[model samples]
Target chain A: MSRVRVHNFSVSLDGYGTGEGQSMEAPFGHAGERLHSWFFETRTFHQMQGRPGGGTGADDALASAWGPGIGAEIMGRNKFGPQRGPWQDEEWKGWWGPDPVFRTPVFVLTHHPRPSVEMAGGTTFHFVDATPQEVLRMAREAAGDRDVRIGGGPSTIRQFLAADLIDHLHVVLVPIVLGRGERLWDGLEELEARFPSVESVTTPSGVTHLTFARP
Target chain B: MSRVRVHNFSVSLDGYGTGEGQSMEAPFGHAGERLHSWFFETRTFHQMQGRPGGGTGADDALASAWGPGIGAEIMGRNKFGPQRGPWQDEEWKGWWGPDPVFRTPVFVLTHHPRPSVEMAGGTTFHFVDATPQEVLRMAREAAGDRDVRIGGGPSTIRQFLAADLIDHLHVVLVPIVLGRGERLWDGLEELEARFPSVESVTTPSGVTHLTFARP
Candidate 1:
C-alpha cells in the first residue's frame, strides 16, 4: 500500500517548523537556515545541489531516504513560493529554480489556482484548491504504487497530521529555539496515539532524529 | 561555583511540560501521569516512593541525578498544589502527604504568600512572593555549597530560563504529543545558544534524554 510520509522535516527545539516573516528574501524568516543546517551539511543535500564532499553520517543517511519511495509530493502554497493571494506572474517557478529536488508530481495547495507548470526534470507543479483529504487523494493517485510525501512549511504538515493522513513521520529536532513561528504541533493533541512505534537517534551534528511510524 | 540545574524534566514531543485543566484530582492536568510515566518506571522514582526494585538503566541513571548535589529546589506554585487564587485553607499542605520526595528546602512561588509548612522529611514548603532572581538568591543561600535545582511545571522553568540563571538543563523528550497544554519553550528564543554542549541518549524505555550544559 502507498504510504503518506513526512521525511527529514526539521523543527526547532520549541517545535517551530519555520520562523516568522517568511519572504522571498528570507524563506525561513528569522530562523534563516538554522533549522535545516544539519541537513545542509549532509551528503544528500550536497548531491541535490550537484556538489561533492559532504558529511556521510547518520544525518545524511536519514536525509538520503527522503526521495527514494516518493513518487508524488503535496506542499502548501507558501513552500512553492513566498507569494500570497493570487498568482501575480506565471514566470515564477519555485525556490528550487528550474529543476526542483522533488522529481515527482507536485501538488501545491492554494486558494488561487493556476495552470499546471512543467518544470525541468520530472517535477510538475499542479496548483489546486482542495482539502487535505482531497489533495491526498490526488497525490495518492499520482503516486500510484509509490508513496506520497507531504512537503511542509508547518501549516501544510499540521493540516495533514490533523487529518491523520501521515503514515511515517521523520522529524529532525534542531537544538535552537525560534520562540515564535509556525508551530507544527499546534492543535495536534494526542498525536502520538496514531504512531505507536517511536524511535530516536542523535546525530553528531547535535540534532536528534525522531521517527514516529504506525504499527 | 554552585550550578543551577534542571534534571529529568519530561516534555511531550510538542514541548508541553504538562496538560491543560489542572486540578486537585489530576495534578498534571489532562496530561495526567503520561508525561512522567517514563520517570515513574525508573528505579530512582520507585525508591522515591519507597519501593523495592525498579529498572536501573539510562532512564533511572538520569532520574537518580535529580536529587544528588541539590540542596534546594525552586518550583512554581502549580507544582505545589491545584489550589488557585487565595489559599482557601492553610491546612492544604501540598499534594505530597506527610513526607515528600524533596528532602531539601523547596520554595513555592505564589502571589498569595502563606506561612512555611514543615513536612515529615527534610522538606519544608516555603511560600514566597518574589521575582525569579529574588527566589534564586534565597535558594542559593539555602543551598550554600550545593547546587540549586529548578523543579518545574514548565512555566517556572521558562522563568528561570528567561532570566538566564540555569547552568545545566536536562530534558527527557517523551514521544506523546499533548495537543493543548502550557508549553515549556514558549518565550525561550535561541536558548540553545547558552548551552554550547548538548548530549542526547535514548533510554531502553523509549524516551530520549537531552542534556544541554554551559561551557
Candidate 2:
C-alpha cells in the first residue's frame, strides 16, 4: 500500500516544532536550525549536496533512508517559502536553492495556485488548492507503490494527522528546547480519537530515533 | 546505570530552543506555549494534574511515558522561571504551582545559589551554581539506578547534547510554524554524530506520537 509517512522531523524539548519569527535568512527561524543538527552532518546529507567519499554510519544510515521511493510529497506553502496569497514571481524556489531534497513530484497544499515548477533534478513542484483529501488523492496517484512523505512546517502535517491520513512517522528528538515558537501538534488530540505505537533507538551521536506505527 | 537522558524538552524548528525575551507572561517567550501541547492533555498529564478521564490512546501512552521513574532532573535558571539574579522571594515556586509535576529532587543549574526548596509533593528544587558536569554528578547520585533526566529550557539541553551525555529523547513533532521564534539545534553537528531512527503513530486526534532512544 502507498502509506503516508513523516520522516526525519525535528523538534524541541520545550514542545515547539518550529521557531518564531522565521525570516528569509533564517527560514527554519532562530533556534530552528538546532533541530536538524543530526541529519545535516549525515553522509546522506553530504551526498545530497554532491559531496563524494561521504557514506554510511549510524547517522548516514538513517539519513540514507530519507527519500527514495517516495513518489510524491505534500507540504504547506510555508515550507516552500514565506510568500502568502498568489505566487507572484516565478523566481522564488525553496530554501535548498535550485534542486530540492525531494526529487519526486512535490505537491504543495496552498490557498493559491501556480504553474508547476520543474527543477534541474527530477523534482516538479505542483500547487494544489483543494482540501487535504483532494491533495491526498493526487499525491497517492502520483505515488503509486512508493510512500507519500509529508514535508513540514507543522501545519501541513497536522492537517494530515488530524484526518488520520498518515500511516507512519519518524521523529528525531534533538535534546534542545525551544521555549517559544511554533508547535508540531497543537490542538490535534482535542479533535478526535487516536491509537499509536512507538519504538525507538538512541545513537552515539546524540540523536534519538523513533518510529510510530498503527496497530 | 544512571545514563544521561534528555526529558520533556521542547524547541523551535528554526533552531531556537527558547526566545530571547524572558517574562512571566511569555514564560517561554513569545509562542513558547505551543511546544508543550502534547504533555498537557495526556492521561499521564491528567494523572499528574489530579484530574480524570482523558484519551487513553497512544498519544496518552506517550504522554504517560514522559514523567515517570526519574530520580532527578536538571534545569537552567531560565527553565526554573523568569526570576533572574538572586533569591529575592521565598514563595517563588514554579509555574506548575506548589505541587510540581517532578516529584523528585530537581537541580537548577545557575550561577546563583539558593537553598533547596521542598515542595508539597515529593519534588525538591535544588539550585546548583557549578558546571553541568558537577550538576550531573549530583543528579546521578540522586537518581541511583534510574536515568538522570536533563530537563531544561534549551541552552542546558544543547550543552548536554554537545557533551554527548544524553542517551534517550522523545521529541514530539507538533504541527505548527512560528515563522519566527527560538530554535532548538543551531550549530552542534560538528561536535556530535548520530542519526535518529524513529517510532511514530498518528492518532485520529491529529497529534503524532513519536519516540526516540539513543543506542
Taking the candidates in order, what DockQ does each have?
A: 0.73, 0.06
- How many clashes in candidate 1? 1
Off by over 4 Å in 2: A53-55, A190-196, B1-215
**Candidate 1 local lDDT, B1-215, one digit each (tens):** 79999999989878989989998899988999999889888899888889878888878888899988999999999988888899997898878778999989999999999999888889998999999999999999999999999999899999999999999999988878888788898888888888888887777777788899994
In terms of docking quality, how is candidate 2 classified?
Answer: incorrect
In terms of docking quality, model 1 is medium
What TM-score, to 2 decimals, does candidate 2 have?
0.54
Task: Evaluate all candidate structures by whole-model CA lDDT and list the values in order.
Answer: 0.90, 0.71
TM-score of chain B of each: 0.97, 0.86
Q: How close is candidate 1 to the true structure, as a TM-score?
A: 0.96
- Residue A55 error for model 1, in Å? 1.9
The residue-level lDDT of candidate 1 at B101 comes to 91
**What digit string (tens of lDDT, one per residue) describes model 1 on residues A8-27?**
99998788999899898999
